[model samples]
Target: MTIHPPDRRDFARSVPVRLWDESFAADPLRHYQALRNQGPVGWGELAPGVPAYVVTDRRAALDVLHDEETFSHDPRAWEATVPDDSPVLGMMRWRPNALFADGAAHVRYRTTLIDVFDLVEPHDLRGRVHRAVRLLVGRIGPRGEADLVGDFAEPLMALVFNDLFGLPESQGDRLHSGVGKMMEGGDRATVGEAEYAQYVLDLIAAKTERRGDDLPSRLLDHPAGLTREEVTWQVFLTLGAGYGPTANLLSNTLSRILGNPLYYSTLTDGARPVMDAVVEVLHHETPLANYGIYYVRRPVAFHGVWLREAVPVVVSYGALGILAEREATERRHPNDASHLSWGAGAHACPVKQHTLLLVTEAIERLTQWLPDLDPVVPRDRLTWRPGPFHRSLTALPVRFSPRSPASEPSGVRS
Candidate 1:
């Protein structure tokens, strides 16, 4: 008897949340456009499941993300791809680490982070954020021009996480590398998950030895309890949560704002519109394109698609770009509609305030410092870094200068 080979139906069109694909690994927006053309929910060929619904439409994407009872964060399809000793899973299993768990668990886990997150809102950390931003811009001024990703974006973002975790400045590089690996999804190979994992292990050990009163120590000492592995996993999540996506936002927003330098004026003048612009930028580019979570509960039906119970659910952070673009076209208040970048429901990023504050602060400072910020390369000529999980720029080469070339450094006089 001859066996039939698998057909196109076997391939899942939507890629796994973090798996890097050449098509998207090279350009995130383009792939998002392609998926949008296929309609709100398309098949994810790269996904492990038999049928994966790719939600791109704004309302529909909102439906999936916000309605956890119907569309659980626990139903990500890529959990199988994660390593057996998955740091992602470690946090999910922990009590206060219940962001990955459903119902009672998610609520408990959220409480811990939400409390801290509420403290980091734009208003709450305004002084420190401005200071961090000014410090970053000042350093970039000496260089004249720099890759925002490396010099400007990374440092500014890493600063927030470091302060939040109370991790010393000395450990920045290690945490940065580990965050990169975590955001890469399946591309954990390049960063060496084992190495990153070991680093987290060491971080926990150091924190335990030092016995500090920061978030790490709190997780380690949670009354509900967590394992060393659990602390390590959350550390990875926390750092990644603060890094890649925000960096991507900086890179992408810089690209957009430089095209319109007037936003700088808006920010410097204390116009609320500037903050709205920054949030719009986050929604527009979608730094954390997708976030993968495991659904430990029952089945979920999104739209007409029926996802089986206990199925893994990967929540791509932003609505499909093309779909959002179209939705923006239809919006009465196109300026105010959030594009679902921070996600919508029970599992929406608990760190939304921290995330937005980082982006807003970075842009606000950079704009005020260098009103003449402009990309050296054209948009089409520029490239965006790719991965299923992150929509970042590999390198965002930019020139920074004063409003007047005569007043600014000769190096960045565009």
Candidate 2:
């Protein structure tokens, strides 16, 4: 299992592949394969002229994820090198939150999040998700056709999250618009980042004046004694992290279920749980595909590659899924949960159970309300949003039998 470093001269000479473009968005596997061809660790550009080493091999990725000593989560060293207007900066920029910290600071911030999130019981979360799904279906059910990504997945996350964060339901659109633009990582990214910052600021300010049973208020009350500024960043990280990936996961899972007639039948007939489809998407096509970003403090040799100081070493979860599939001699069951989609080691997703509950429940509720829902276009023909960090769809249009809101079941009508 030992992987020795490749020849430094040849590795240094290899050209970095571009990841933040239409080609990568349209056919990510093709670009992943191109990176794999270079070696376990391949050079790639996250955006125009932004070069970094993208780790495509599972062993190399695991090595990077587990070895915090060699690879640091802090990107300040590299951040200073990038332009102020870099599209990727929104994602990679250092914050006081757990995602960008290392050592004791990481532990302090991470503990506060875990402690607060642990208070959310499964039943409570499921109820919130069901309520959001009901509201969404009521709006779209009467139309007979809707973009699931826009009309359902995105809004569902916003509604549930807004409720959990103690914001008015009307403010969900702000959370959705800001996070969506920022995750897309382009000219609008800066605007998205600013909008999201203001949204978090407002939430903190409101909670400061009067606390509530929401995440921000909980963080403020935690024993960590985090200052107002610290609380704001934590809320920013959690909301942005929770919303974008969960929305994408729900949309991606729906696309898989609706795209296959047999699968849809199994789901509607109760032969399979919606969770099976969700797990299948996690294994084959994860939402936050290549966002496990790490940086080295000094030039170091790792798993057959030379990692330059402060350069990003991205773990391609999408590529890792493909590689795992190819390397497997036996067929993997649909419910297998071995994928690295939630990431690994220290920075692994803290709210994975919450995320799973939200997505599965949302899907189950939607399918139950509209059993004959069908994709307007084939899944293969659908377009993806352009970005290096996320695997998100631009839209998922679908058609179903129309029903008036008044005719729907009593509790769900908007």
Candidate 3:
């Protein structure tokens, strides 16, 4: 059944709420809930003087995600309403990648990418993850103190991605650094983006001769007629999207295990499955908080809010996911995979299985290697990154008793 937009007259009565404020970045969940109380949709600035329509309503978010007809993933299709200088343009800019395409373009890009991912054997990926875990744990297990974010999760995820892409550790590190700077918009963003793009092109060029069972080779050899630029953008998107969330998942959940006594005991005692803990972390503290940007194709009203042509529509994923979690908690329900963590529709993340296996294995290995891990600082004292799109800690300093060499898990390569 087709869902038509609301009347324009209906939108005239509601006030646009501010969302790009510092308070929103610090504590988006609280602000989003307050916005929800105001109405289903509201206006906010994505960057200074750059207006966007923020959708906090669950049903409205789903509709926007699924309905690509009225909304477009391609920001270039929009009229020149947003200034070229807007910081958010860095994020919303058009790319030949699957992320910003629609219709046949989206299909072709997504098909090639998914086919490549399908080539990954789960057991092999798990082994790769374990190797990464083993390397990281071996480095820190003897120290008895570690910053989980810096010393473990980030580098471990980098190694896993390096394995997947057939890239050397040094090249992968540079790629990650460039991507991070680009995502962190400012004076450095333009240079970061250019350097990152150059790195991708160089990586793809290098991979053509050193072909193997890696993603870049698979995409390059796909039946689909993708341009070299398309292949590079797809790889960039995959690496950029995959690493941050996976690393955040590992660090955040590890923090929970170390800081929350009750939750830690439940996992260690085997009263709950480890997967259950992973699911709860996804539900309560979704790694990539706000994402899924869609521009209004034309002037339309949706869920009592007016969406003007070319205006950005931002989905509050963290807020909505936590709301779903609260509902489940109230009902005493088992963890459901329907949370908005992976997003909602055609544009949803395609590598759920890969992400899950990577995070799960990493967490399990950490817990087993350091059963007595605990936080170095109070839970409230831990710092978080000040951004609307990500929910990540600045650091996760933790301490643990050194495990004996004989106590290390079996099948973990030294």
Candidate 2's residue-wise lDDT over 63-86, tens digit each? 888888888999999988899999
Mind sharing the TM-score for model 2?
0.96
TM-score of each: 0.77, 0.96, 0.90
Model number with the top lDDT: 2
Give the Å shift of residue 346 in candidate 2. Answer: 1.2
lDDT (CA) per prediction: 0.58, 0.86, 0.74
Worst 10 residues of 1 by lDDT: 1-10
C-alpha RMSD in Å of predicted model 3 compared with the true structure = 2.9
| Candidate whose TM-score is highest | 2
User: Residue by residue across 343-392, what tens digits does model 1's lDDT show?
Assistant: 55676667765666666666766665675566787666766554455667
**Candidate 2: residue 198 Cα off by (Å):** 0.8
Of candidates 3 and 1, the better by lDDT: 3
Runs in model 1 deviating more than 4 A are 1-19, 25-30, 37-39, 45-51, 66-70, 75-96, 119-124, 186-192, 221-229, 264-273, 292-302, 306-313, 329-331, 401-414
For candidate 2, list the clashing residue pairs, or say none.
5-304
Local error of candidate 1 at residue 353 (angstroms): 2.3
Q: What residue runs in model 3 are displaced by over 4 Å at the alpha carbon?
A: 1-22, 77-79, 82-85, 270-272, 326-334, 403-414
